[model samples]
Target: MNIIRNPKDVLSGLLFIALALLFGWQTADLPMGTAVRMGPGYFPLVLSGLLGLLGIIVVFNGLRTPGEMPTGIAWRALIIITFSVVFFGFAVRPLGFLPALGVAVFVSTLGSRLFRLQTALIITAVMVVFAWAVFIKGLGLPLPLLGPWLGGY
Candidate 1:
């Protein structure tokens, strides 16, 4: 019989379960009407249930298997990605789509070990164009193409 005592694994499993539950609860507000055409809630609800199930499996596996250790959390990458999201949210309205998206892409790439200045710039530019083409031209999301300097109003 294996005696499991990995605090990190237990905590992570619990956290995943909690997050899944939270997502499920929040998604409840979305309409889940017909089976033929699933409402917004359907996808999130299903995904959350799957996540919670996975969390349970993780916890059970940890309990059954001893000597299992959790990997170290990448705090720097986490912080950078988080801040990038925040930057995207704040900059989207004021700085407009292109600039905001560029910054977001660049900041997000910082999390990767292979990130370089030139690569980041290239990726940012490509992503910006892609966003403009897809969201603005294709979907007509009305995202501003130019920055405030050009008086995009």
Candidate 2:
């Protein structure tokens, strides 16, 4: 009797479509130039279109086939990861990019059952170094390694 055979896929497809529409709407004001002379909005609009197309396909497929519902959620991991993100957002200005990112990455790793302090430390170090290389040195973002709280300019 249910028209939607796969409820999860249908819901996810709808979510994707909604996101695509929202992004497309936001990008509408920006000028989209020709392919050869691409504008700031060009790539985003193209991506949004692709996302919408994909969502349509997913919805059709879901309606055509049956699928089991998703298993129980990973509440612990979800909570920890969410907390880490919020902490990073709040701490970034005071702690600076490197320290905030490092702490966030490390704390996020603890959300996993296979968490190891040594591994988390290594990941934190690598992520901090990579972020510094990409955002600071390569792209020349004006983020400080340390903030005013830590005597950095």
Candidate 3:
């Protein structure tokens, strides 16, 4: 008589619950006004509550169902993707938006099992162009194409 079933669902539910708690705590200081006059924390608090509720539901479902544990984790993809995102955040100021984004996208693509250099390059190029169009041109943001490290003021 196994008490725990569907390990994947339980883990996912726990993750969501943890995120909900984090966000909720972070927004606790902000003012939450009335419905008619919403404040900064209102939406975030609502979303957090919803996330917690969803997590509870998922956990219950997992407990009710009978399923096997997840086979294995994709450590390479996980590490690469996480590293690329952190790198982009840190490099954005020094390397600028375009270069940082390009490098991050290319490196992230390498995390895929079927990754190819050419494919990664193409994806990086497309993402750079799209970001430039949408964020720089369309939104009229002040982000430079190249930063101090690349000597683009």
Candidate 4:
């Protein structure tokens, strides 16, 4: 008999699939233009579809794998994450995207059991590059890359 040992992956996969379906259903009415000129809902729909695909893959992987049960929720980590998101929102305008993201990541890791400033800074730096590439370059978002404090944007 096939054992689905990784219950977490299975549950998360199902949840992601549900989310994708919801997103698709909600945006069904929106025009989905060609790849060259996408409609408002085009990106969301694509993202949802990709998420659904990943969910399916995760479910399959979970089915064949053995994994431990989930432990109790980390309340401190959760609170830190929530607050870091709030920090990011406030810091974005003043500090700009990269700086705000760095600060947010640095602050968020503080609540973790394995809090490491060096690791947080390293991760934040990597994410900054990724965020810059995805948001500013790939998505052509108009977020300020550098804030006024750094120099004239």
Candidate 5:
């Protein structure tokens, strides 16, 4: 029996619900103080509850409306994106934050068939600078812009 009229909404709702549950479970041990003097768990629990409520609404909406059939996931795109993230995790220390970020963004762009080298380069440069500012300048995280090999040490 076809239970879902909109597969995308149903799947998205389920994901949100799962995340909410996980978040709630993780915060269960933390003390939940009052709204005025909120504890560490307060915000996460409230957000998770709201997310769960939204998920229920979306699931009901999906069940009530007709939608397109579920399409196959783009495996190539998924793999490329995942690899890019993993690569960045490993590359950050050796390659430095800027280079690692550049490679990650560039590799992720390749996940799309419309990837253009020039566009990727431009995007990489912009994102690198943005990340540098946010992580290094704004937040003052001590991420090396250039690694030891590049004299960033």
Candidate 6:
């Protein structure tokens, strides 16, 4: 039996395979120790292998079936999310963790159909506090609590 032959699926599969190979190649240089004590490269190597396998499966499935394919890319949401991430990266250094996170959340929430201003605010607050508490305070990741106001945390 023929599997789905959709342009979107084929493109996605190819992209996944390329990314997996890139990741695998990047991780290959890292040291891989014995099974008892895994090295830094171990997890990435395994993950890349799995990704490659999934990509192959997707490609094969696509080749075997032919059908109408819905447009895979949601450009609006994708653009919004991408910009939000970019904004987060830029704002995190200058605006501090809390404000950067709030803006990120707000920008990201704009992608959703059900987003409300109040809910976005609440979610941003919750996410910022949670991230601060968990990553900065609890895990002790040295993230900047304050921005340029205090000259870099």
| Residue 77 shift from truth in candidate 4, angstroms | 2.5
Error at 119, model 1, angstroms: 2.2
Q: Quick one: best TM-score, which candidate?
A: 4
Residues 1-153, model 6: lDDT tens digits:
345567566767888899999999999889988666778798789889899889988787778767567656678788998999999899888888777888888889998878799998888889988999987987566778779965765
Off by over 4 Å in 2: 1-69
Tell me the alpha-carbon RMSD of every candidate. 4.9, 4.8, 4.9, 2.7, 4.8, 5.0
Per-residue lDDT of candidate 1, residues 1-153 (tens digit):
446666566677788899999999999889986666778798789889999998888777667666456678889899999999999888877788888888889989999988899999999989988988987997566677766755676
TM-score of each: 0.59, 0.63, 0.60, 0.77, 0.66, 0.57
Evaluate all candidate structures by whole-model CA lDDT and list the values in order.
Answer: 0.83, 0.90, 0.92, 0.87, 0.90, 0.82
Give per-residue lDDT, candidate 6, residue 14: 81
Q: Among these predicted structures, which one has the highest lDDT?
A: 3
**Candidate 3 per-residue C-alpha lDDT over 1-153 given as tens digits, one digit per residue, 9 for 90 to 100:** 876688888888888999999999999999999776778898799999999999988888888898879789999999999999999999999999999999999999989999989889999999999999988997577998999999988
Cα lDDT for residue 72, candidate 6: 62
lDDT of 5 by residue, 1-153 (tens): 798889888887888899999999999999999987878899899999999999999889889898876688889999999999999999889889998889899999999989899999899989998998887997577888888767788
lDDT of 1 at 151: 69
Going through the candidates in the order shown, the clash numbers are 0, 0, 0, 0, 0, 6
Looking at candidate 3, the ten consecutive residues that score lowest on lDDT are 34-43
List, residue by residue over 1-153, the lDDT tens digit for candidate 4. 648789888888998899999998888999999899989889889999999999999889888888866676789998999999999998788778888888888888788899787898788888889998998999898999777876638
lDDT-better candidate, 5 vs 6: 5
Q: Mark the regions of model 1 whose C-alpha exceeds 4 Å error after superposition.
A: 1-24, 31-70, 147-150
Candidate 5 residue-pair clash tally: 0
